[model samples]
Target: MNKLLVAEQLVVGWDAPVTRPVSFHLERGEILALTGPNGAGKSTLLAALAGQGRIFSGTLFRAAGARLALQTQGLPPVAGLPLSGAELLALTGASAQGLPPWLAACLPLRLDRLSGGQRQYLSLWSVLASPAELVFLDEPGNNLDRAGRAHLQGALRARANAGAAILLVSHDPELLPHCDRHLMLEPIS
Candidate 1:
């Protein structure tokens, strides 16, 4: 397979090792689900992969020239800003062709005027639709309504089909069915 990311006995953390040494590999056109209870280092691992967190041990390898996009938990502090959804997409270079009708209609509206879910979904699309070869999403389902979740699943599938590797960190079981494989992280004692 075309490996985009490979982690061998990887241990990631902020101050110290927060994750047990775990190993995994990801390839283009594949969706990998990272799951575990709270404090299991799911988000930490994603951060480490995105070059934010520290890798205490082992190793992580990425395709030499691959670009990446990451969407972390919580909303961006763009509220009250003058940015519109369309502008956000433009900044990220993400297209609006596949946006849901409701969100599409709100494209011209300032981001602060939209509901939380709308903002969340729009932020997510910024990452999902970007040209990045690898995508990392942390708690992607947060604040999303039922329809939003459904759309997320479809978007993930489409991105994978289009040859982008995704590392999804979600607690929602609904997303697992869309993933090609799953890795369960364990908390350290």
Candidate 2:
């Protein structure tokens, strides 16, 4: 398969000198799971891969036509925001066809009133609906219950089947079984 993303000697951290150099490769139509103890720089690595964080050293190569999507851990309530679920999905350039029935039904409700899992599911749907080649999911199963997690997993598998590369970061071990490969990060001493 063609390379979708490559990180060479990547150093991810907020502190100076970076904890240590990290490197990895991501291929198209594959899933890579990132796991490690808290503060191992998992989130930082994801941010860097998504081009949202600084790269202390090394280069990040992204294939042409590759689009990156990120889903943060905390699903903050957007309560008073004027935007509706459909509008939010539109903002991400995702098609409305990908949204789940429950989320579609709750679109008319305010974001604040929706349950945590509902928001998480909606956020994921918005990203999946987009025309993205690579997606970064940070703690995707955070607020999701068993059924919700199952739903999210199915959606992810569907996306992968559709030829999208997925990079999932989660503390839940349940997600590892679904990934094609797993990368365990360690803090640089």
The lDDT per prediction is: 0.92, 0.79
Count of clashing pairs, candidate 1 = 0
lDDT of 2 by residue, 1-189 (tens): 478999888786655533367778888878889888887888888887777677888888999988888876776458777767777777888876755676789886666678878877887778766889998888888877887777777788888888888998887878789888888888766
What's the true lDDT of residue 44 in model 1?
92
Per-residue CA lDDT of model 1 for 44-111, tens digit only, reads 99999999999999988999999999999988799679999999999999989889998999999999
Best by TM-score: 1
For every model shown, the clashing-pair count is: 0, 1
Where is the poorest 10-residue window by lDDT in model 1?
A: 71-80
Q: Alpha carbon lDDT of residue 180, candidate 2? A: 88
Backbone clashes in model 2, listed as residue pairs: 94-129
